[model samples]
Target: MGRFEGKVCIVTGGASGIGAKTAEMFVEQGGCVVVTDVNDAAGEKLVGDIGASKAAYLHLDVTDPDACQAGVDLAVEKFGSVDYLLNSAVKMAPGMLKDLSLADWNTMVNIGLTGSFLMTQAVGNWLIENERPGSVVMMSSIGGRQPYGMSGAYSTVKAAVKMLADHFGIEWGGYNIRVNSIVAGHIETPLTAYLKDPEIKRGRSEVTPLGRVGQPVDIANAVLFLFSDEADYVTATALNVDGGITRSVMNHMPGRKWS
Candidate 1:
């Protein structure tokens, strides 16, 4: 039997990138999933690929609290009950703080940080009301724990997600709910496809003790573990799935010499 056999899951941003891969993994593992995103075309196509009987698509805007709650309701409505929630939707606007507009800052904060909280709050509430114990896997970043220039808003909001995960992990312990974040490094997802230079991307990878950049599946594997019954005792932590990228902050200086 698959790890997620007889499970029900909701995957936000399931249209593409890491979210898409995670949704695929869940379904492949025998989980029935509701794949949600604002990208109607892509989301529907993914549902089709996963098989409508095994998966369904929903249009979602995670930043909206009502919408967030509604998405959870829909998941339970469709699949009986939600056993796992994966908050993977994000907006990464690259810019410096001084150069960024208030709009840009709010956009990142709302979409990345606030959105995760709302989803957790909404879903956690549902689980509580139904007396169901569930697991949540939030998508955090190496940027959240580390400081990087030219990644102003993205970095700031990611950091906020880490804290949110900690807070939810503690507060929801009574509910038998596990909340955690994945501090992912340079994963080759469509989201980071814009960084096309080999030198630029390779430099990020070379510092990793693993000697490679992360793949979406790497992050998905971590998510699978956190959501599984095997990790019933684990909660409220930001696990680094960065191929050891965060192992040495000092690697930065030495890595610069290679440039």
Candidate 2:
């Protein structure tokens, strides 16, 4: 049997990019997935592609607590129980701190950080009530640790997501619920589709020790491991699946400034 056989997973932001890829992987591994996203058309398309027997699409606005709760409820109703949750929805508006508007800042934090919290709470409570164990994987970024210029809001919320994982990991460990964050580097997803130019892609790849931009599958594999029983001992940690980009800070600097 596949690794995720008989598992039920809820993937937020499942219409495209990493979320979509991860949902597909889960279904491939025999998991029943609830794909939630605001993009109803894409979400439904994905569910159809995966086959209705293995997947279902739900319209979810992560920023809304009611929607978040409804998504968890749907998963339980459809699949009997939720075994995993992948919080991958995010809203990024690049702007310098001084120029960033208050509305933009709130929007970023509400969707990225607050939305994650709401989803975690909903699933976590269900697991606790049912006396079942579950795993949660939140998508974070290298920007969380190494801030990026013109992305102050995104970076701040990502950093908070790491801490949020830690808090949940500790608070829910006694109940056998694992919580962790994946700190991705420069991944080539729809979220970063703006960097489609060859030069931009090459520049990002060259800076990484691996000499290539990361693919959604790279992050998806990591998520699978974290959710699998193999990682039963791992929790409250940030796994960097960044092609060594985060470690090669000096390589990223122009002309080796310090040296």
Candidate 3:
């Protein structure tokens, strides 16, 4: 049997990037999943590709508390109890703080930090009330480890996401609800594709000790470990899946420009 056989999970931002890849992998591993995103088209297509038997698409705006609950509800209704939550919804508006707008800041804070909290709460509560154990993985960023210019409030929000995971781990461990955060390196995802000018990619690669950047699969593997029983004893921690890039921050994201 596959690792996630007979399990169910909710993947936010599941229409694209790391979220999309992770959802696909979940279904491949025999996990039923509710894949949620505001992009209904992509979300539907993803479920269609994964087949409706093992997956469902949800129109979720993670920043909305009701919408977050709706995703958990959909998972239970479509499959069964949700066994895992991958809070991957986030917005990255690249700009200096001086050039940042209120909208940019709020969007980042709402989607990345607040949204994570909402989803984790919904899942954690359900797991607790149902008397089941589960896991939650929040998608943090290497930016949270070090301040980076021209990344809007990304660093700030991701740092908060880590803290949220830490807090949940402490508060919910007694209930057997494990919580952890993943700090990803420069991943080559659809969301980061625009930042992939050859020079910038090279800079990221050089800074990474692995002499390469990360991919969605890298983060997905880490997330799955956290979700599985193998990590039953691992909780309340931040896992850096950054190719050792965090040993030193990139001097600057070169070739970054204002739109």
lDDT (C-alpha, whole model) for all candidates: 0.88, 0.93, 0.91
Error of 3 at 53 (Å): 0.3
Deviating ranges (above 4 Å) for candidate 3: 249-259
Which lDDT tens digits does candidate 2 get at residues 156-193? 99999999999999999999999999999988988898
Please give the clash total of every predicted structure, in order: 0, 0, 0
TM-score preference between candidates 1 and 2, better one: 2
Q: lDDT-based ranking, best first?
A: 2, 3, 1
Tens-digit lDDT track of model 3 for 123-232? 99999999999999999898898887889999999899999999999999889999999999899988888547998888778878888888899999999999999999
RMSD of each: 2.6, 1.8, 5.1
RMSD of 3: 5.1
On lDDT, the candidate that comes out on top is 2
User: Candidate 1, residue 68: CA error in Å?
Assistant: 1.4
The regions of model 1 sitting more than 4 angstroms off are 252-259
**Best-fitting candidate, measured by TM-score?**
2
TM-score between candidate 2 and the true structure = 0.96
Q: TM-score of each candidate?
A: 0.94, 0.96, 0.94
Question: Candidate 1 clashing pairs?
Answer: none
Residue-wise C-alpha lDDT for candidate 1, range 26-65, written one tens digit per residue: 9999999999899999999999999998898989999888
